[model samples]
Target: MKRTPFGAWPCSIARAVDLLGDWWTPLVLREAVFGVRRFEEFQRHLGIGRNVLAQRLNRLVDEGLMDRVPYQDRPLRHEYVLTDKGRDFFPVLAAIIAWGDTWLSDDEGAPVVLRHRTCGHETRAVVACAECGDPLRIEDMEALAGPGLRTAGTAGTARTAGTAEGEPTAAAADSP
Candidate 1:
């Protein structure tokens, strides 16, 4: 069966998953953040097949997360570098690391520890509210209809005909 296209979803998380949901994609990004730039380095670090690694690298470049930069003159060698968007993915990786260390680590403890550069203290990633700067808990948040949510009859079904720009439509407001 054909899979649903997550890019078409109105949710931001769904769209992000559409782009970065694949297993190898995140691994590749992890290596990139750790300073693995050359094809051989990524292949060696990941132990992934050459064709799959090449495909993932190409996809990352095509998706604007990485840029291929020429490093050698004679053989036309290139290295992958993270773009601004790719750099922005570090927090996501940090959060994953924090979760893994907390729940998956052995009794000896986490394999790696992150230290803050300025204060020289260990740090862990946490999800916090942008406005209040308070750490967020899953149980404390509620999902609410946003303005970008697609309203009925606009593309799929017949319902309310008009919704003001930036206003949640009646159909969306009524949806659980």
Candidate 2:
């Protein structure tokens, strides 16, 4: 069997792992999205070492996913704030939570359910067809390479066409 270097693959998922791929990274993002912004907060919440937390925060800031803001002047204290790029990850987090709840949870349902403010009911994250409002299925998609995707293959190409472009293509329409 042929083997490929894990990092050598030109895929978005692989690239994402290279950047935010640490086992601790997603937990850090999870805390950040849930309003834990301070270095101390992250350390406390995740029980991560101060050094590791600092490194992750610095990396996130360098990637433009987070920004450091001074919250206290006397001690030169700062807090991390999510940038638009970081804020945009809410859907990704929601999908992850939904999956874990479905597949990993015991008899309990989702640990925390999302309730839409407009409608008084629980909501599951849905990516639907804009034109016909139909729910999207894994088969209902394709991927077309962009500049970033020039080198990515299977892993880099998880961005489904219908989801990325918000329109069903001929291939998507062919799904039974």
Q: Pick the candidate with the highest lDDT.
A: 1
Q: What lDDT tens digits, residue by residue, belong to model 1 across residues 59-159?
A: 89999999999999998999999999999999999999999998999999988888999999999999999999999875445455555675522243333
Candidate 2 residue-wise lDDT at 114:
76
How well is each residue in 41-68 modelled by candidate 2, as lDDT tens digits? 8999999998888899998999888999
Distance from true position, residue 35, model 2, in Å?
Answer: 1.2
**Backbone collision tally, model 2:** 3
Error of 2 at 172 (Å): 13
Candidate 1 Cα misplacement greater than 4 A, ranges: 1-3, 150-176
The lDDT of model 1 is 0.87
- Residue 115 of model 2 has an lDDT of 79
Model 2, runs deviating above 4 Å: 1-10, 130-132, 147-176
Which 10-residue window in model 1 sums to the lowest lDDT?
Answer: 152-161
